[model samples]
Target: MKTLPSQLTPFVRSDAVGALLAETLGHPDAEFTLSALGRLTGVSGPVVHREVTRLVDAAVLQDRMEGRNRLVRANPEHPLYAPMREIIAATYGPVPVLRAAFDGVDGAEHVYIYGSWAARRGGEAGPFPNDVDVLVVGDVPRRTLSAIAGEASDQLAVPVNITRASREDWDAAEPPPFLRTVRSRPFVDVMTGAVHGG
Candidate 1:
């Protein structure tokens, strides 16, 4: 892993770091090395190593050595992973709700509710859960996506982000608004780059 230079920002031990890493692991197939992990967490290599080791010991992350590289992944069953990913995505920018907000009719393709609050907010607030972050991307219509975003917000009973863009936007832009914003943060850049035409 490259030793992060002083010019880089520090990763704070907060929802952003946790959520970004959590979301990165949303797919079991997601893989990365220490340098990648450092960028994802918005932390230096040493900080990431310490946090990852702690998570591994706590059973929140499972670690493997891929040659000289150390790989880390979230334990899928961890109660916090899903919500955390959504929250991290949401914190950086708006995510489309299941509704197609992008369409004139308020229809949407898929919406992922994420973050700590995405895990623990249920009307009766006993605990001060984190914000309800989200990621929305799919074939759903714009209007419909917008309309449903309100309902989804009410259902989650928390701040909901909507990431909605035209297919053309996602296919052509090197860093769509969402991806660029996600990468522009001081502490986290969960998405390293945009998939041109996936």
Candidate 2:
């Protein structure tokens, strides 16, 4: 797994730890098995285990054995819970937030996060991105998409820009200049963690 830049998640020992924390703390009420978290974060099992062990030791996470599977969740009682949640929410919340907001909107065929945010998430070295750029390829109305983007912006404390395109345009026989650019660059699928391009 590629290491997350320290600037992407300051104060974390490694990118794996930051990602693991994002999955666990981002959904405080949810409990995840270590293997599940490993898959979610794209971290290997041993790395996930090591990081979870560290967090458990520090009381940032609570873990228990359920037969053979270990379930882990954020410790609400941890003094750093709120602050850490805030940090993770600001740094790594966009994926889950946008995914939840636009995953299965009627008439939508694909949702992508492009531009600097996606580039950084794909492990590029750069300054922090101030806004998130999203491309929707489907028949969803622009007004509805704008409203969703507005809500997601508030939740993420960042501007969420929406670019709408019809499925026809997306699958054009001759792709537009803009589509060519988007296709050549790194972007993340909101419903899936797939990253395309560099």
Best by the TM-score measure: 2
lDDT of 2 by residue, 143-188 (tens): 8998999999999999999999888878887889998888888887
- Runs of candidate 1 with Cα error greater than 4 angstroms are 1-13, 77-198
lDDT of each: 0.46, 0.83
Q: Name the 10 consecutive residues with the lowest summed lDDT in model 1.
A: 189-198
Q: After superposing candidate 2 on the true structure, give the runs of residues whose Cα lies further than 4 Å from its correct spot.
A: 42-46, 168-174
How big is the positional error of residue 104 in model 1, measured in Å on the Cα after superposition? 23
Candidate 1 similarity to native, TM-score? 0.40
Return the TM-score for each candidate structure.
0.40, 0.84
Please give me the total number of clashing residue pairs in predicted model 2: 0
Score candidate 1 by lDDT: 0.46
lDDT of 1 by residue, 1-198 (tens): 332221111232543344335434544567667687655344566766776777778676777998899887767778876765554433322222222233343333334443443332111223444344545544665565555667756644555455554555534557576645533332111133111111
